[model samples]
Target: MLIDKPLPELRRYRGRNPRPADFTRYWREALRELDATPVQPELVPNREIDVPGVECFDLWFTGVGGARVYAKYLRPKAPIGRRHPAVLQFHGYSGNSGDWLGKVPYVAAGFCVAALDCRGQGGRSTDAGAVQGNTLNGHIIRGLDDPDDRKLLFRSLYLDTVQLARVVMSRPEVNPDRLGAMGASQGGGLTLACAALEPRIRRAAPVYPFLCDYQRVWEMDLAKDAYAELRDYFRRFDPCHEREADVFRKLGYIDCQHLAPMIKGEILMYTGLMDQICPPSTQFAAYNHIRARKEMVLYPDFGHEWLPGEADRTLRFMLPLAR
Candidate 1:
């Protein structure tokens, strides 16, 4: 409620960002390109961390634009021929996959966990830098000036998630039918993208997701922190606001709200009503468009930070996948 619309109004808000006229065709072509690219997955054993009842590895795969993507993979030791459930964990903006110990809780429950390190961020993943545009500030506007919309950095990042999911699902010990995805902030947005592009994901939990309703964030004047790149992009490139609508329309291809309708997995979204970083209305914009079975948990007084007990709630929400 802090600067956003009231809770009731937020629930009814669809979004203000424009969806590209070729949205579906655009994504279909992206998927086809991903399909053509060889995953070339490699899992190198991590000999440093010794956790009882679990095996760990540094997973690497080739993503679109030939960038080498990385992820932390952990699987519970199980009887031969037994396949277990798996979860894909994406990290926040500018963060790498977290410590291996953080993923043990899922492994302890007879599940496999793969934490992705988004390309070009604070991780081992390599950025191909193939796009033609201002790469000065953030990935959100990485390819804004390119004639080809597919050059957008986020387009590649979103495909990386799907490719990772496919590699994880191909593992002999993982049950493809029981895969789930979760993350917060930028990671949360990726979770939605992964689920939308790979419909086989059984469940998805996105916590106060970023990369949603860009125009809404700009209009609300809440684009300063995590979304600061928006302001920087305008100041450096289109200071006169002449290309505002065009810029936002191009961004629509990467917006989570536009992808929400394509998600087939059951979704459990978390939102902090008082959040200013990713305002409540912006979060609701994506949440409201989800056509899948879904639920939203709101914190009346919380901001964009931690939501007490969210970890436990997410664990319980995803527990059904193990069965």
Candidate 2:
């Protein structure tokens, strides 16, 4: 496991980041804002992919702060009248909803699929850029300098997942009760967040989620690669570590570990013990806090990269939703 903690320790980890006292109230107000913002969803037919059994479309919806979020939507072609099970797929950080062909397996299994393209990433979504801080390095610290913690970019990003879920659920052809979500890395974190914010999510599979235990990452000095923004933020904004506690306290608003307890769905989390990018302990921090029906798949020899048979296992885990 290299420098990663032992399995026993990882399982018991509760995370090191501070949890804001008003964490629940903060999200309540955020949800209130999302409720007021109209999600104007539009679907444009995609003619490029020549798949036989599925229909594809470019789905667009207005997210929080009036940003237009995009998702690649696909559904079975033959089953038109009845509603079908649905799955929401989120991508890794700085990435977009992948090609339409990749989502065909769910459609083939008679499931409606929507893969979100996070705002301001490598996709069609638009970033409002309305925050008041340094936006140079990454999304993590985009709004750290703002007095209002609501300005945090991840707050809006997390709310976008909820908005997307609502839009998918509103579709006449989607069975809301059978809805599931799955993702890796940043997407994994968003999966946890989505399931947390929207209790309607029936199943969730998050593979080595990021955005948990920020202070732990910094403390361990593993903030170089995916968490480089943490190092950058401290160096550029608070070099003297003066506002260290306050900074992490504000970040507590977006940490996935704090949000895990809010999930009401069944969860299947995957963690690679040798992962330095998002260390195993950090992933377990959120996983351990989940109060819902949950299970974990640990890869003893694996790291942040791909784990063998993960795709097949994920497909099988989510297959029950199709019933």
Query: C-alpha displacement of 87 in model 1, angstroms?
Result: 0.1
Model 1 agreement with the true structure over 108-200: per-residue lDDT tens digits = 988999999888888888886743222335888889999999989999999999999999999999999999999999999999999999999
TM-scores of the candidates are 0.97, 0.97
Show the colliding residue pairs in model 1: none
Off by over 4 Å in 1: 130-136
Candidate 2 segments whose C-alpha is farther than 4 A from its true place: 130-136
Estimate the lDDT of model 2.
Answer: 0.91
